[model samples]
Target: MLALAAFFSGAALRICDGLLPRLAADFGITAGTAGQVVLTFAIAYGVSQLVFGPLGDRYGKALVVCCALFGCAGAALACAFAGGFDMLLRLRVLWGIAAGGVIPLAIAWIGDAVPYEERQATLARLLLGTLSGMSAGQLGGGLFADSPLGWRGAFGALCAGYVVIAVMLLARLRSMPSAPPAQGGRLAFFPQLAAVAAIPWARLVVGAALLEGVFLIGALAFLPSYLHQRFGIPLSAAGALVALYAVGGLLYAMAAKPIVRRLGERRMVLHGGWIVGAGFAAWAVAPAAWWAGPIALVVGFGTYMFHNTLQTHATQMAPAMRGSGMALFAFCLFLGQAIGVWMAGASFDRFGALPLLLLPAVALPLTGWGFSAALRRRAGAAAA
Candidate 1:
């Protein structure tokens, strides 16, 4: 039920990605400016996680998550009826803030319920729900928009899903675990925050996850329009192609444990980074429409492979403070996403889509290499 709630919350935001061009056309805006609609959501999403993380730690995961869902549902309904681009943007920001708690809280809930050695596979399954929900959102939103009901109808459908999930969550709230209060009152929050900050490995994990968010959200948000403009594909067709990105993520989730075991986290992350970089470059330079599909698959697979490992690593990093650590990690990850969307929007506004692709291709690999190096240094210090 928790995972399902989280999935719906995430899917609601992703559905917006597919509707951007249509929404822009409706409101008399450019694709770049429409992209800002996504940026507003990303900014709110990232910033809200910081507060929600601590709130979850202090109050309880289920309660916080349920409330977030209700808020997200209300915000989605507002977005459905929004009169202008600004109104929709404002609603999206509110929706982002409300939905932000779902992911971290879900993960923390898993941590409370599951054991460490078994967590990798469980986390992968949870991520599968997340990735699949994203794909479904894009595909479903595209189809709904193409129907007589239009984009608003599509959003209204997602809003309905949110309400159903929230009701289910509220029913389950009594069975959920709550973190114990700290000795230092309000000051206890500082220690968990400080603990995550002080750990080099934790920092590396968060950094890699942030880069993953940059490539994942930024690419997904912009790619549909890019394909539409470049290949003259209809929105539905473009969204279907975008769904291939999640197919890649599904493949990674299926294969992550063995890959992580064989190659280790550092090597896998570095390799995944290179693969993602290659995928982005392919998308940027592809000479034909047929090529874009495979490139997206590669990029999606690599992005999730790296992200899954980072998330698993984060869960293990500070087990005693899992909620706090995970929250901090999620904070950085979403902050990167917010920045990615903002930058991608600006890049699209200025230089057009072609240039926007280059940023992730270069940034992802460099960040991956940096993370790998940091891990190696930590291993050496441990040996000493």
Candidate 2:
């Protein structure tokens, strides 16, 4: 049930990626300008992480998640009714702020509930909800936009899903027995966040998360647009094709246990990085639109293979302050995402998508190897 609820927020986050072309056309703006919608939402999402994390830690992660789900439903509904680009953008920011609370906190909630050795497998299973949402968001956004109901229908459906999930989650929250307080109640917000930052391992995890957002997610936001322009494909086709990325993610989720058992976290990240980098590099040079489908699959697979490891580490970063720890992790992530998308937008405007995709191809493997090395060093220090 929690997984089902998390799906809506995940969908809301990526839905706009596939809709950018249609939005640009509707608003009579350039593609780069339309991309600002993504930027604004991500910025708000990043900023709101501070509020939700602390609130979750103080009040209870489940309660906070339930409330945020309600807020996301409202914001998404408002987005459906927005009369102008400015109104839509504002609503999207609200939606980002609301939707931002769901996933990381849920992970924190899981961290609180599950033991560390088992947590990665549990998280991988939970990602089914998230990865499914990613696919639905991209495919559904494009399909709805081109359909008679148009882009508004896509958000309307999302709003309805949010409401349903919010109700279900709320009921569960109310029914479940309350958890004991952490830190004798919540510490003051800034101090809590500062303490999280002061931990070296926490710093490494969060830093890697931030760069992951910048290098990988930032580049992904432009895939549909790139397809539309480069190969003259329709937005819906491109969007549906990009949905293949989720196939890769789902595969990882299913295979996670064996992969982890065989490769260990460090090698999983290192190898996943090379795979993702190869996928993106291939994407940069793909001769036809059809090729992106399979390439996106590989990209998706490699992404989770790498990212899920980071997520697992984050869960254990500050066990006592799990919510705040996870929130800081997400804060760095979406903050990096906001900045990355902005920079990538400028790059897209200047150099086009080739460079945008190509650069990540080289950087992601390095990112993976670096994070792996850090993990090994941290492990060695602890053993010593």
Candidate 3:
């Protein structure tokens, strides 16, 4: 139930990305302006995790998760009835704030309940829903918008799903154990925040995760519009292509444990970064629509491969302060995404979509080099 709730919350946000074109057309706005909906959501999503993470530590994961889901559902319902573009944008910001807690809190709950050795496989299962939800958001949103039901109806359907998940979560809340009271005052929170900030390896991992967010959210949010503008494909087809990106991620989630076992997490992160960089480059140069599918797959797989490893390391970084650590990790990640969307939107407005792909192509390799250098330094320090 917890995992499903997290999945739906994520899916709801993702659906908005694919629905951008139709929504923009309906509201008589530019694609760049419509992109603000993505920006608003990303910013709220990132910031809210900082608040909810501590709340989970102080109160309980179950309570935090339920409240976030209910809030998300309410926001989605409100969005369904939004009177104008501004109204929908506000609702999206609220929705992002509420939905933000679901991922980090869900991961923290798993950390509290599961052992380290057992976590790889379990985390993979949880991520399956997360990635699948992203895919559904694209495909399902496209379908909803194209059909007689329309974009508003699609949001309504999401609201209904949220309600069901909320009910189940509320019922199950009593069976979950509450976290013990955290030590110190509100000021103490700063120390944990500082602890995460102080760790060199943690900073590197967070940087990589932030880059991952930039690539993932920025690319997915605009890919449909880019395709329509460049290739003149309809919205549904473009959305379906975007949906295919998740197939690669889904495969990586299923295979990640064995791959990590064989290759080691650190090496996997390094290699995955390279693969993603290559994917971005491929997308930049591809001459036809057929090429987009394969490049997107590479991008998707590589992005998630590193992402999974970064998340595992983050959860282990400070076991005692798992909530704060994970929350900070999420904060950096979403902050990167918000910046990516804004920059990409501006770049698209000025230079066009093709140039935007170069940002990740350049960024991923640099991030990968940084990760490798950090790993070597950690090894040398241990040897000394």
Candidate 4:
């Protein structure tokens, strides 16, 4: 049920990638300018972490998730009929705010529910729902943008998905025994967040999450467009190929259990980061359009390899305050993504795609190694 609810959030996050060119054309803006559609949403989603994290602690995580799903539905509905680009951006802000609430809290809920030893595998299974939705949304955005139904239709579909999921989750919520909210009151979430932030390990996980956002999520946003301009692929086709990113994610999801057992978190992050970095490096220099799909697949797998480890850490970072911990981690994450997208858009406009693609390829490996090193240090400290 939680996984099903995550589908719309992932869908809404990536739909703009496929819709960017069409939005640019329709709104008489540069493709870079059209990227504000993504930027606004990301910013709102990031900023929302401040609000939702503490609120979830004060309220029930499941109930917070249910309400936020409805908020996403409302914002998406508004987005469908936005009269101007400005209006669309506004609606996206609302959409972002709502989306901010869902996944982090859901993970926190999972943290509350699952044992640490088994949590990573459970999270991997949940990721399948998100990756599947991302695949459908990315492709649906391109297909809808190309058809008479258009980008608005894509949003309409998102709204419908959110509504249905929200109802289903709400129903599930009712059947379950209610969890008592964490102790707090109005305006107390900030101090709660501060207390969690004081932990050295928590800071390390949050920082890595921020870098991952910028390097991966932010940079990858431009890939569909990169394929379109460089290879002259149709937007729909470009979207289809890039949507394979989720396929890569799906592949990792299926393999996560065995891989976790074999490599554990340290080696997983160590190798996963470089693998993703290498995939992007390949993307920068791929000789032909045919390579896009397979490369995206590889990149997606590495992304999860790196990212799921971070997620597992986030859930446990502040075990007593899991809601605050996850929220802060996600906040910096999308915040980094927003910064990444903005920089990538500028980079694309000024320097072009090579730098945008290659930079992360190089930087991500460092990110992985740094985090893995920290893990080793902690292990050594534990052993001592």
Among these predicted structures, which one has the highest lDDT? 4
Kindly report which residue stretches of model 3 are placed more than 4 angstroms away from their true locations once superposed.
Answer: 177-179, 185-187
TM-score of each: 0.93, 0.97, 0.94, 0.98
Candidate 3 pairs with clashing backbones: none
lDDT of 3 by residue, 1-384 (tens): 776986796687678676778887888877878888888988999998888877788778778889988998999899899999988889889999999878888988888888988787778788888888888888887777677777888889889988998999899998987657467677777777778778777787787788877865676688878887888877777778878788788899888878878977668778888888888788777788767877777777887777777788788877777888888899988898898898888888788987688778877877776776776787789999
Backbone clash tally (model 1)? 0
> How many backbone overlaps does candidate 3 show?
0
Evaluate residue 236 in candidate 4 and report its C-alpha lDDT on the 0 to 100 scale: 93
| C-alpha lDDT (0 to 100) for residue 106 of candidate 2 | 88
Kindly list the per-residue Cα lDDT of model 4 for residues 322-380, writing each as its tens digit.
88999999999999999999998998878889988988989999999999999999999
Pick by TM-score: 3 or 4, better one: 4
Best by TM-score: 4
Residue pairs with backbone atoms closer than 3 Å in model 2 (clashes) = none
**Model 1 accuracy (lDDT, Cα):** 0.79
**Candidate 2 TM-score, C-alpha based:** 0.97
Candidate 4 pairs with clashing backbones: none
**Residue 101 C-alpha lDDT in model 3:** 76
Error of 4 at 305 (Å): 0.9
For model 1, the run of ten residues with the poorest summed lDDT: 178-187
RMSD of 1: 2.1
Q: lDDT per model, in order?
A: 0.79, 0.88, 0.81, 0.90
- Find the 10 residues in a row with the least total lDDT in model 2: 177-186
The Cα RMSD of model 2 versus the native structure comes to 1.3
Candidate ranking under TM-score, highest first, comes to 4, 2, 3, 1
